[model samples]
Target: MKVKAYITLKEGVLDPQGKAVEHALLSLGFQGVSGVRVGKYITFDIQVRSEAQARDQVEKMCQKLLANTTIESYQFEIIQS
Candidate 1:
């Protein structure tokens, strides 16, 4: 099974990188762009026979390593490969 995880900063958290991108876009004449938030996408294969097992393992991975959990939130999807 393949798992794709999306990790993002929680609301009310300041994102310096996102702000920099937004400023650059404005400078490049991209108009009316606001509330830019940057995030992480990770994809990997997990050896699991069932979706439930995969989900469980992925959740643990995110909590333990992939995401900050305090300032970041995460979501994942399972893809059979």
Candidate 2:
């Protein structure tokens, strides 16, 4: 199975990189940008017998290593391979 994770900062958290990207977009004459937030996308293959197992494994991976639950949140999707 293939799993993908999207990690993002929780609300009310300051994102310097997002701000910089927003600024750059505006400087490039691409207006209409009110707010910008940056995040991470991770994809990998896992050898699991079932979707349930894949989900469980990925959830643990997120909680333990992929994300910081205090300041960041993560969501994942699994694709059968």
Candidate 3:
């Protein structure tokens, strides 16, 4: 199975990188864009026979290593491959 994980900062957290991108876009004449938040996308393969097992492993991976859990939140999708 393949897993795709998205990790992002929680609400009310300041994202300097996102802010920088927003500012650069505004300066380049990109309009109507606001509240830009930057995040991480990870894709990898997991050896699992069932979706339930894959989900359980991925959740643990995120909690233990992939995400901060305090200032960051994560979501993942399992894709058969």
Off by over 4 Å in 1: none
Q: Using lDDT, rank the candidates from best to worst.
A: 3, 1, 2
Residues 1-81, candidate 1: write the lDDT tens digits: 989999999999999999999999999999999989999999999998899999999999999999999999999999988
Q: Considering summed lDDT, which 10 consecutive residues are worst modelled in model 3? A: 42-51
Model 3 lDDT per residue over 1-81, tens place: 989999999999999999999999999999998999999999999998899999999999999999999999999999988
Q: Over 4 Å off in model 3, which ranges? A: none
lDDT of 2 at 34: 63
Q: Runs in model 2 with CA error above 4 Å? A: none
> Each candidate's lDDT (Cα)?
0.97, 0.95, 0.97
lDDT at residue 42 of model 3 (Cα atoms)? 99
